[model samples]
Target: MAPMAEPVAAAPAPPHFVIVPLPAQGHTIPMADLARLLAERGARASLVVTPVNAARLRGVAGLAARAKLRLEIVEVPFPADSGLPPGVENVDQITDYGHFLPFFLALKELAGPLEAYLRAQAVRPSCVISDWSNSWTAGVARRVGIPRLFFHGPSCFYSLCDINAATHGLQQQDDTERYLVPGMPVRVEVTMGTRPGFLNSAGFEALKDAAMEAMRTADGAVVNTFTDLEDEFIACYEVALGKPVWTLGPFCLCNRDDDAMASRGNKLGIDQSAVTAWLDAMDTDSVIYVNFGSLARKVPKYLYEVGHGLEDSGKPFVWVVKESEVSTPEVQEWLSALEARAAGRGLVVRGWAPQLAILSHRAVGGFVTHCGWNSLLESVAHGVPVVTWPHFSDQFLNERLAVDVLGVGVPIGVTAPVLLFGDEAMRFGRADVARAVSALMDGGEEADERRRRAKVYGEKARRAMEKGGSSYESLTQLIQSFTLQGGKQH
Candidate 1:
């Protein structure tokens, strides 16, 4: 008999990724989700996070274990030179506004070790997916002969807004004047008063230059938004940046499972079951879910006005309040009064709520949000109409997308430019709040139309995440591109 053919050698694994995320809750969540998506597509993924961030990501590690995916978490010590306090690994921990520079500088200091770690890996990563803010990683990837892709967590529309502003020259625009973005499918207005402070800051200019240079020279960009949601903006961004763009998100939707949902729900320290039970008792589309995100510091007076407004609306609502924000006697008193006035129709959770779980629930009809990208996507994914209250960077632009481009949101009178550090001095009276809530939750022809549009968009978002959908196709193309030639930039 002919000698048995030697066992065929196993083919090598597909492209392995080294994902470096900015150490913040918003950045961390989507970065982790991207890693999971990569693993699902048969790529090995290693997420690099600071030690403190590593601890916060334990839940994700548990998630990977349960799913039995090829994902690993690599701890890279946050630089000692960052001058940050012992336990402060994230931007949110730098309570004092003065520490912002040091935090920015500290992020840069991680580059050396990151390069060293990449060089030492047994199977070198074929691609590096780093936060766009982490501009130094581009050079590191170059040194190691691998392609690097920048990841931006905000909407493509917001990016286009920034690009347009930079192109038109920030010096040419007056602080109070509105200007149209150059390449958008629809006209969107922006003013200096509405732009983020970092856009003009001398120090931020340096970082922005470095990031833009890296982005221009890097392989491509991977944004946490989908094509159907921002097709025009995505195309414009690609033309402006001169690189291939991958829109593989609504990343939150990609990883929605009972276990993943439960794990995320617990992170906010909320009892998921308890929250669901409360929703169970409410009528369909009766409750408005309110959360201003973890970072937006609510002004006490504004918080008080919100309390009175919710009370005036007389509608059932669930408000997610950060425990730290309301710890003061004055805010606590306002919260207590608000609760008393609501007469058992309102529930104020003083910790993290299961945001996705809450949004997906049938009881939640409207979202009163700060217009953060993640919250905006969640609102759209769940078919919940929004009352937009944009108070910071990229939020105002996102609000325009929801209210104008998408036609699924109502504005709540917050239009001033918000500085990065200071609170917005604008106050919404109780009447303003009540009116917005009533228009969203109560019956009205316009509100019904907005809700109908919102539901249609939500169905589109869901379809985009399924096999053969736009988002799924984008992910597949991204993976295939990486495997075949590492990466290609226009």
Candidate 2:
């Protein structure tokens, strides 16, 4: 009787993930959001970043505490000898594009320290979730005998279009030649020059090749997109990538709470309250919202011409100008003049902006965006039409998703894809910007149709994130799969 029964052993906890996103905002934000999503679904999570980035993400600890989620912030010192300026650990910090090569070199040095850190963790990481830029993580994951999942921070449509463009030999076409992306759900046009450099340049090819090779060798991909929005594209992406691809995305929707968002501080320093108040004062669907994301650096002339375009649109607007790019006194003077001329019709946010809040507001009629995946998803989620101004990388392809696949946008005439630090073949003038903005917001059959399609898509996006939705189910499956693998390890 005294030795009746021994206490049953407790079941082990789920997998612990070590997320290593590229230091860029576009990559970091989505990765962070994914971590939050995993934690919400009952998995242990940790994010590794440079000490500088860790400080930026300190608020996350408080966020997790409030949500009662499991998350830890692990910091590794950035290589001090790496030639980059002190505290300059991100791509956005390289004011001169000439330093990009050196910047990449510095990023490569992070792998060693990160690997050592993971090995020393008490609960070994079951997987290494890394951005496409961190190709070296594949090796690290292999060394540690863990799975690696590549993260693509863009739409499935954009990724598939790029894959199809390569498959159809569109990569060889001239700069301005428009060719249909093969095997797409709808007709989308792209030019050879609009493709990312890894496709053409000898030096940059190494990075692309490494990323693709890593994906081929890894467990699978975790794309930042959902099925309902790009069902056809998702199918095509799976076939092209030849791996099990999961379309659990619009990670922005994962954190519906205000506290979660506040945790990711606005790096741009814009006044959130004032911007919202101004937007609140505008009529529904009357004001256009403008932003080029964190990394885009528009030349002074381009900035001035865009200002003129905003003025000429005769529509209420809010524009975010990157602080680093608009440093000169002349540009500042131009911005001051633009704000003064608006006479309360516009708001110019110079530093940081709460982009999600702005997009969801009823007053935001259209988005003039650089076509970053996050911005594109936000615009689509809010059902706001777009005036696409693609700058680099996958942006041009994302523009096609809006203007071509979704029919919810008009291009601002960026025909040739501009490379990082490459010479501009054509400068965007005021006329082009004004016309694109007008086409999106001005009353007309075309604009109305675009608005209708956008609202419908937006509704669908919202539904996909709800309970029992496509994205919701996909996320559950993702966690379960990894958790099982983690259990096997122990």
Which candidate comes out best when scored by lDDT? 1
Clashing pairs in 1: 193-417
Error of 2 at 371 (Å): 0.7
What TM-scores do the predictions have? 0.94, 0.93
Residue-level error in angstroms, candidate 1, position 366: 0.6
- Which lDDT tens digits does candidate 1 get at residues 220-251? 89998877788989999898888888998778
Stretches of candidate 2 exceeding 4 Å from the true structure: 1-9, 165-168, 171-188, 196-202, 419-424, 487-490
- Displacement of the residue 279 alpha carbon in candidate 2, Å: 1.2
Reference-based TM-score, model 2: 0.93
The C-alpha lDDT values of all candidates are: 0.81, 0.80
Backbone clashes for every candidate come to 1, 4
RMSD of each: 3.0, 2.5
